[model samples]
Structures are given as C-alpha cells and as structure tokens.
Target: MLAPAQSAADSRSSVEQLVSRMSLEEKVGQLFVMRVYGHSATAPDKADVDANLREIGVRNAAELIRRYHVGGIIYFAWAHNTGNPQRITGLSRGIQRAGLAQPTPVPLLISTDQEHGAVARVGRPATLMPGAMALGAGGSRTDACEAARIAGEELAAMGINQNYAPVADVNVNPANPVIGVRSFGADPCAVAGLVVAQVKGYQSAGIAATVKHFPGHGDTESDSHHALPTIRHTREQWDELDAPPFRAAVAAGVDSIMTAHIVVPSLDPSEDPATLSRPIVTGVLREQLGYEGVVVTDALDMAGVRQKYGDDRVPVLALKAGCDQLLNPPNLDLAWSAVLTAVRSGELTEQRLDQSVMRILRLKAKLGLLRDPLAARREVLGTVGAEAHLLTADRIAGRTTTLLLNEGGLLPISRRSHPRVLVTGADPASPSGTTGPPTAALARAFAELGFKATALPTGIAPTAANVEEAVTAAAGMDVVVVATYNIAADGPQRILVSRMAATGVPVITVAIRNPYDIAQLSGFGIAASLAAYGWTDVELRAAVRVMAGRTEPVGRLPVPVPHAEDPARMLYPIGFGAMYRRSGV
Candidate 1:
C-alpha cells in the first residue's frame, strides 16, 4: 500500500513537470479530443486522404497531433470497420507511434465508445458483451465487473486506454429513444451499485472507466444525437433519481465523467445544454458532487450542441463550462482557433486551461501511457477477443436472458415434439432501426436447437403488406417468435407483431433490443414475452436456449416496462422474471 501511494505521488510530480513545459498552444490543444479514421495504411491514396479529410472536416491524424498537440483521438465505425483485431491493434499502435514522434511526446489517449452490445465501435474483433441494461438484469455485480474487465483488457491490448462506458443513466422514461438498453435500469440505487462495480472492474484492468451522459440522459424522450432534450425534474426529484448513480460513480473514483447534452431548467435556466452550462457541469458535478476527476463532454459535433451554438463556438464554451476535453468537434481547426482566441481575449483564462491540461496529463500518467504509449503486436494478438473473454460474454448473456411473460406456459417449446417454429422480427444482417443481432441469427439459433425454424426476411420496417404476408406464413408454423427492436422509434414493427399475435398462433414476442418494447405491445394477444435487451448473437442464442428449456431464464427486468397507454403504470416492474420448472421437478 505504501509503495502504491509513493508511485502515485511520483506520477503526480511527473505530470506537474510536464505541464510546466507545455506552451499555451500545446496546453489549449490538450483540451481537444478529435476523431480519426483508421490507420494511415487504411487511407486509400494521397488523393483519397485529402478528399476524406475535407469531407469529415479534419486534418491528418499525425499532423494534428504534432501541430495541435492534441490530447486524444477517438475511434468511430470508420476506424474499426474491418473487424480484424490485428488490423485495429495496428491502427492504434500506428497512431501512438505518430504521437511519440513529436518533439515533446505525450502518449495519445486512444479512446472509443466501447459500450459493448449494440453501441460497440469495434465489433467482431472485440468481445461483444451485453449492454449495461442486460448486465443489470443479470443482478450480479460480479458479472458486470467481469464483463467490464474483459472488455478493458481487450481495449488495453489494442493500445486503447480509455473506455467511455457503464452508462449510469437511470432509464425512467419508456419513450426515451436513445438510452433505453444503454442504461442499467430505472432504479437509481441499483444503477449506482452496477456503475461502481463496472468502474472498479475497468480501472483494475488498466483502462480508465468513464461514466457517461452525466446528470442523466435516461429520462428524456429526445435523442441528443439529433436534437436537445430537456429533463423537467425538480431539484429534489433529480437528487432522488438522476443524481445517485453519478454520485456513486464519483465516490468510486471514476477516472472520468461525461456530460450529457440535455437541459435541466432546475440546474440552469439558460437554454444551453448541460455540456455548455457552467452551473451544471462545474457547479453541480464538480463543486456539489465533489468530483475531482477529468470531465469530458459528449461529442461536440452532436446536433444537440451544434444546432444551438454553431461549430466554432461550442468547443470554447464547453471548455469554459468546465469540460476538460472536447470530443469530436465537427471541424477541429475551427474549434482549436476558437479556444486560442478565447484564451487570448480573456474569455477563458490561461489558468483554467492549465488546470484542465494538468488533469489530462495526470490521467495519462496514471494509465502509464506516458511511459509506454505503444502496444506490442504480440500482446494484441494474444489477448483480444480471447476464448476466455468470449466465454465471459456468453455467461453474462445467458444470465441476463429474461422471461418477461409466459401467460400459458408457452415457452420451453417442446423439443421432443419437434415443433416447427417461425422466427420473424428485425433483420439481423441489417438491423432495421438500431444495432443488435440480426433476425437471421435468431432463426439459426432455433435451428441449432433442433427446431425447424423458418425465418422471414421482412426487414426491420414491416409494411402492412409485410404483416399480412407474415401472418399468412405464420399459419403453417406451430409457434411464432417475433423479435422486436426499438419499438419506441419503430412503431411499424409493433403494429406488425400485434397483427401476428392476433392470428391465433402461439406468439412469443422477444424484445431483441429494448425490454420496453414488451410494454408497448403487451395488450396484444401474445402468448409469451421475453427480453434479450440486445440482439448480439450470444444473447439471441441464450434466449433460444431458455425457450428450448436447455437453459433457464434467470434474468430479471432491469428497468420497469411502462404501460403504453399510461406511462406511469408499470406493466412489468423491475426484478420480474419467470423461472422454468420441468413438470416432474
């Protein structure tokens, strides 16, 4: 313990020394966390690189780091689309190599939105664990910890040191379009428990954990990606529901906290979102909550901030609002210039800029990035998506396979009788509205379970004609399993499933993305209901095992499934799950 304490002191000293040497431009640069496509090799030709950079409104990766002295780089779908672990590892290493070549080298914090499940940026190459809501349904902090650890290890191996995950949002609103399955649950205390566990697990594995969308993004009905949403909770209500998990995360020593783009009139009357509100980001999160760690803003390029503040002004405003890092500014050059201008014009003090840069440097030192920024190719090959990691993912998925409703004991479909099944829902190959496992994968899982499963290719959005065709096809099947994606956004799917339920076939509605879908379509004459919470192949297989009686449905609902008609009334409350009992047992 004494040794560790001494090491921490040494790291702090090193960070302070480094900050003392950085120029004003370099210090300002450290506040910006820009985006980059994959490795330089992945860039087509010189012409393509120029064209792509122009299109995305950013400069070259190495040039940005060397010239701007950027603190970090976040990987998006374009960066890791190849789904090759080795290739991704190479890309990460290449970026670090470029950063190291700078005159005053600082290890770049290679980060990604590795939220797992549907929101994973690096898909096949990494272990695709279930999302936070599924892990919450597992009802085991041990499982959440293990899942986060495995994910962290994989990311650390790939030279990525920061994980923006363990969404602490208490998803209370059924109609919340963006944060349904990403959140742990509706209950704040339970979400707090899981958030602390995940933060510890990620940190223990050497990857910094960032509890995201602070002040809670779960209660709002709008998607910040498209528009700003407001949380109309009173101060007392916010303290009770939205603030607990974030408070718990801060207490757990979470390395970073991400600001949401939602507005809360109680915190700040200004129309500015929390990402640009000093009263919320600085006053509430830092001063009131006592969070001394780094505070990062969600993507500055998001429409929530962009539409209101314009690209040039948002970054400067965010920094002044107490955000230490600006993520994915639409135009890096413009954002950087604005920050420089603000500091020069006395709008943002140099001391404030140094304070943030110091925090960032300290975090980098803590992660040992300053010591060895590059990852070894051998370690990347040996650890990423290893068998053990995949197994851990499978275990979490299995544990969280919830049986929400089985009105007539319709589940555990009799394999002995060889039931012919019809698996129709969102197409997994090209999931209709959201990301998850494909419908084809669920059908395949049924086939693997010794059932003659026929899959319909009715895409995610089923037309009225598509529903008629599915109902006509369901007539021949003994049972119908309809997997629903985001029903809040995809209303047509719910309508199609309702029509299928009316066809007199034993309809099993499996919520493949958000569990709240069950609540939306509950009044329909569905025989059974299940919540997979995600559409990952592992999760789909686990749900199939539960249906086939091979694996028990042990998962409880993490968040309350509200009634479609009355949002206040819960159709299936949290902690609800039905266990399968064999007849003789």
Candidate 2:
C-alpha cells in the first residue's frame, strides 16, 4: 500500500502524463460532465437510447462516451439511469468499458446528486439517509458523519465516485424556494461544523466529496431552475454568512466545490452569476480561499446561469470563469463546439484548458478510476442497500423528528386510547421529484404499532373537494394525524388542517418537508406538531415511533420558524424542541 503522500504524488504525475498526450478535443471533453438518458450503457437500440438520441444528440450511453469523450456522467432517476444495485453496477461497468475502448482510453467519472433526504437521485433499493437539515436538527457531528459515510459507501458500491452533496448553504430565508431543507441551518458556524464532518465522512468512503452552490444559495427567495436570483450581501456579510462553510470545506481538503448559479453583487459587481463570474470563481474561490481542487458548475441548463448567455456561450463562459467541469449543458453539441471554437480562436488558451483538465484528471486518478472504474455485480448487490445500511438510515431518521408544538400533551397518545386514527394529509412529491405520498407510510407505521390507523391521501395544494373528503373521513376517528408540505399561510392545505381541527378529534400535525408549516397551522388549534424534515418512508416510520413513545424526539429546529402573520416575530427559535414529560400517560 502506498503512503497517502506518495499515492497523491504518483496520481499527480500520472495525470500530467495523460494530459500531455491528450488532443484538444479530448482535453475540452474532459471539462464536461454531461447527462445521458438510459438504463443500459452499450445498448445500441432501445427506447432509453432513443431518449438519449433526442435529448443529448446521442444514440446511447456508448455513443455519448465515444462521441463526446465526456469526462463525467451524472445519473438522475428521471433519466432512467439508476434502477437497482445490479443494474447500476452493470451500467457503470459498461460505460467504463466504452471509455476504456477509446484511443486514449481514459476512464469516466460517474457522479450523482445523492445528498439523501429530499434531493436523492438514487432511491429505494439504495439506502435512503436523512437530509442535511435533519442532520442539523439532530445536531450531532457523529451522526452527520455516519450518514454521509453510509451514503458514500452505498454510492461507491454501485460505481458512483462523485457526490454533489452536504449542502453547505446556511438557509437564512424560509422563503427560499430551492434550498430550504437542503441547507444545514441558519447558523454559519454550525453549518460549517457539519459540512466539515460530512466532507471527511464522504471522502473516508473513497468517494470524492463536492460541497456545492458556492458563495451560498440559502438566502435567495427564487429558484435558479427557472429565473435568475441576485444576492445583495455586502462583502462583510458574505464573508460572515455565506463563506464560512466553503472556507471550512477547503480547510478540510475537500475534493471539489460546485459554483452557485445566483449572482452575488458583493463578490462580483458584474451581472454574471457565480458560475460565470471570474471574479467570484477565480478571485474568491481560488485565490482568497485557496481551493485547488476541481471546481464544477451547477447544471448549465438552469436558468440561473443562462439568463444572459445562449447555450453555446454558457459553457465557454463557465470554462473561462475557471470551472473545471461544465455539468449538464442544455445542448451538448452547441456547447462543445463553442468551447472548441474559443480554444481554436485563441479566446481560451489550450493552457487554460489543460489546467482544468489536469485538475479533473487528478480527481479521477485520486479516486483510483485511473486504474479500475468498473464494479462487480456480486459486490454491488451485496453492499448497496444492505440491511445494516437500512438500519443506520432508520436510526438517523429516529434522531431527527422534532416535537415543536404539543399544546395539550396530545403526543405519545396511548394507542389504547386513540385506537381509531386517520392519517391523512398532503402527499407531495419532494423537491428532487421522487418519494411517494407519505400518508400511507405514516398510516402503516401507526398500524404496526397496534392502532386502527387509516390513510386518506390529500394532494399538496388540496382542493375543496379533497378537504371535504378528508373531513368526512375524520368524523369517526379518535385521533387525526396530518402531514404538511411547505404550506403557505393562505394555502388550501391550511384549510384542510383547519377542517380537521374543527372535526372535534385530537389533531397531530407533522411537517413533512418544511418545519415552517407549523407556523401556518397556528390559530387552527392543532393538538401537536412535529417537524419530520422529509417525507421518505424512513422518516415517516421514525416519526410514528416517536409519537408512539417508542423513541425520544431529540431533534431541534435547525432553522428558525417565523410567525405566519408577522414573519418578523420568532414563533420558535432555532434549537427549540419540546420534550415529552416522563409522567405523561
């Protein structure tokens, strides 16, 4: 076994040798991390292949590898890329074979957005750990590290070497549409601590950790997926609020840092987003903070980075801004040609391209992908969603259920007394576009605990008809448990909870996605409220156990809960969580 110092030296030397022998085309391709639609890698003719041909302008995964010479591939569940452990391993092996078959024979870096909680791309059969806010709520660096380590192990088991995770943003704005539960909390120091823990944990599993949305995406009200959002923090504020976690991550020797698409006027006065701002990317991240690792951009397809530039120009701008990887460009052909043209025209020097390519190659070499990037089917199947991993997820989830409001000591209701229960609420899909309705999961969990619990699914933005259906069903129930998902103060889901409260049955509300839902549920007079942070099955089951007094509610509010009416008043401060009295029956 090579010493860590010697292994790093050898990796750097090997990366330099490989870069010296690469063509401009291969070097430029090494800077891109594109997405392709498929389950199988080398399958030449299939529906999935046709989808890739239509979207990425490629026939299949093999064509993507052969034609683009892409340095990385990001797997998305919606792209039909990940199915199960065996399938993912097979795809990884096949894609690696395609890349190794090339004239230069460079291995591809396979990555995914497996941050767990609400933003996981690989689901089900893979271990689903708690999200960032959940870890923050639990407030234990040991738990945070363990969760990330388990996630890294599972991801690596299936041949994914990179994870765009451990969101370092301090979520100061409850109205942030994109990064609410994704962030650790509003406290910079606390967030920094957890981010460092997660980075160490992830890298310990031999997967490269990428701390993301640089400068910070937490305080913005808008989602960068649709429109551009500008952050107006002063240089002092940016240094205090948004820069600590990244600084800590760099200090921890993080492998990569992903740029946010939002514009920070303080970092760069120009209208360019961080992904396209040389001042922010090169000036702040590179020189000020001393992050020598690979710097990847958020998806080029996001409107946040494309507001001013066309598809072809976005990649060029990101590359020129010092980004080592251009992720998920909207049009691969246009972006590829634009970069090639820029280099050929002397607008982007080959030396510049070589710099980014060397960092990327060093990352691949560091992951041992330079030697072997394939996964054995038996090993992957044995490790991906092992029973021990599931238990770890369940234990972590158990630690994150926060009891915010128990007005009448209505929690831990004796299943003996509250024998008749109805589990009904908004079953909304998570921000990642995965996870089914959590109501059924909640109901099943209660049923297993010896209660006659029934579930009635209510859409996220419930209609009058949906409310009436749930209200009518709750008439005979002894207790009602409703889950809320980011409910606005005036949203129809509030009406659903109000009607449930009016039914004269004891009401227990679980905030499935956002903890702020409890503020909206105020004045409706619910009996108890808990913040589950996410709606995954593990989270729901853990909440049920907490409500049943099977486990203690140890999680605190990671983010502050503001008053629904005033918005300025603190309804519950950060780290506030009610505990059950030992004498409560």
lDDT for each of the candidates?
0.82, 0.88
RMSD of 1: 2.9
TM per candidate: 0.94, 0.97
Query: Model 2 compared with the native: what TM-score?
Result: 0.97
Candidate 1 clashing pairs, residues 3+ apart or interchain: 428-438, 428-439, 437-535
Compared with the true structure, what per-residue lDDT tens digits does model 2 show for residues 344-391?
999999999999999998888778777777644237777878899989
User: Candidate 1's residue-wise lDDT over 166-215, tens digit each?
Assistant: 89999988778899888888989999999999999999999899999988
Residue 384 of model 1 has an lDDT of 83
TM-score attained by model 1: 0.94
Error of 2 at 283 (Å): 0.4
Pairs in steric clash, model 2: none
Top-scoring candidate (TM-score): 2
